[model samples]
Target: MFTRADLGKDERLDLMEFTLVLEHLGLSWTRAETQDRFEKADANLDGFISYAEYRAILEAQGWV
Candidate 1:
């Protein structure tokens, strides 16, 4: 149950945009890895992720 409220104090990005970024990295949205990343990105337990969240993960995981 992902929603915008999960962002907490983090910045915000559209859900589609977040999914797109992951897809571009060859990550399957239906896979556990994607789900894990989504949970991490959601931060405050909300269902959405901000661009900053994506950037943080990209940096941490060296995604690109």
Candidate 2:
């Protein structure tokens, strides 16, 4: 999932890549919901979600 979402292959997911992951998962989230999830995963608010953060979020969602 992390590799798939890291579209840029930068080992991190920017907002666009995150959105793609949600879409790929067929998760229909509102704009606010998506932003909220992104913010939660991006613990450092660095505008990117690292593999660790992505894994953490997936684990929290029971998807890991």
Candidate 3:
């Protein structure tokens, strides 16, 4: 049911939205905790969350 519109203005995945998706998927984590999670997810360290990175985060959160 997910769609491209879930992404942010920059067309990148926003951490807040990502967090919500994780919650909906029955996973839990704090915003502060996700900071490092995001950093690790941003494989290229480009400061923007890529689709691959987002998927990785979800997997790491046990969402998939």
- Best candidate according to lDDT: 2
lDDT tens per residue, model 3, 13-45? 666765665567665777787777767887988
lDDT of 1 by residue, 2-48 (tens): 23333443455445556666666666766666666778777766676
- Number of the candidate with higher lDDT, 1 or 2: 2
Candidates sorted on lDDT, descending: 2, 3, 1
Residue 47 in model 1: shift from native, Å?
A: 1.0
Q: Global lDDT for candidate 3?
A: 0.67
- Per-model TM against the reference: 0.54, 0.90, 0.61
Runs of candidate 3 with Cα error greater than 4 angstroms are 1-10, 58-64
Please give the TM-score that candidate 1 achieves against the real structure. Answer: 0.54
- In angstroms, the error of model 1 at 20 is 2.4
Worst 10 residues of 1 by lDDT: 1-10
Off by over 4 Å in 1: 1-17
Listed per candidate, the RMSD to the true structure in angstroms reads 6.7, 1.0, 2.9
lDDT scores of the candidates, listed in order: 0.61, 0.90, 0.67
